[model samples]
Target: MVDPLLLQLAAAGAAIVGFGWLALAMDVHWEQAQGQRPQPAPVVRLLRVLGSLALAASLGLCLTADHASMAVLVWFMLLAAAVLTVAMTLSWRPQWLRCLWP
Candidate 1:
């Protein structure tokens, strides 16, 4: 049987991470439009990292507490991580991206 609590937690985590990404994107764009460098603030960076970790933990929780399959968990985690990566890429310059990515 599906554990309702696990499902609720997973959904909440996903929503939080998704909204975080959207906010990051909007902030970056707003800064760029105002003729400012679109660098991520320290708090934003911390939040991104924390959000990624939380999403990963949420996936693990779902896997353990519910009947979710391994494949589903893996894909969901990967997708969440990928969104963070893409946001980082778009919000920073090439040198910053290289330093972070490489």
Candidate 2:
């Protein structure tokens, strides 16, 4: 039988990686639209890289979590991450996000 917890962790990991790519793409598009001279902002780039690393670590931790309940919580967090991605894609309207997130 397939382990449900493993499946949940795999889904969470995929979601995190997917969002990381999406964020990178959005950053590129935003920069291109600005039409400013492309200058690498060290601090901002460092933060984004660190954030991606953190998400990868979270994925690892989620996969190793032993408790089924913890897996469920991780799944919920993954869902929240997906929702946040959608909200960001939709221009980050406060009211719509507040209804679901707050």
Off by over 4 Å in 2: 1-40, 67-90, 94-102
Cα lDDT of candidate 1 equals: 0.52
In order, candidate lDDTs are 0.52, 0.52
Ten contiguous residues minimizing lDDT sum, candidate 1: 93-102
Q: How much is 91 displaced in model 1, in angstroms?
A: 19
Q: Weakest 10 consecutive residues, lDDT, candidate 2?
A: 93-102
Could you tell me how far off, in angstroms, the CA of residue 76 lies in candidate 2 after the best superposition?
12
Which pairs, if any, clash in model 2?
none
Cα lDDT over the full model 2: 0.52
Off by over 4 Å in 1: 1-3, 14-22, 29-40, 68-102
Model 2: per-residue Cα lDDT over 18-72, one tens digit each: 4543343344533433334353566346546654664565555565654657765
> What residue pairs clash in candidate 1, if any at all?
none
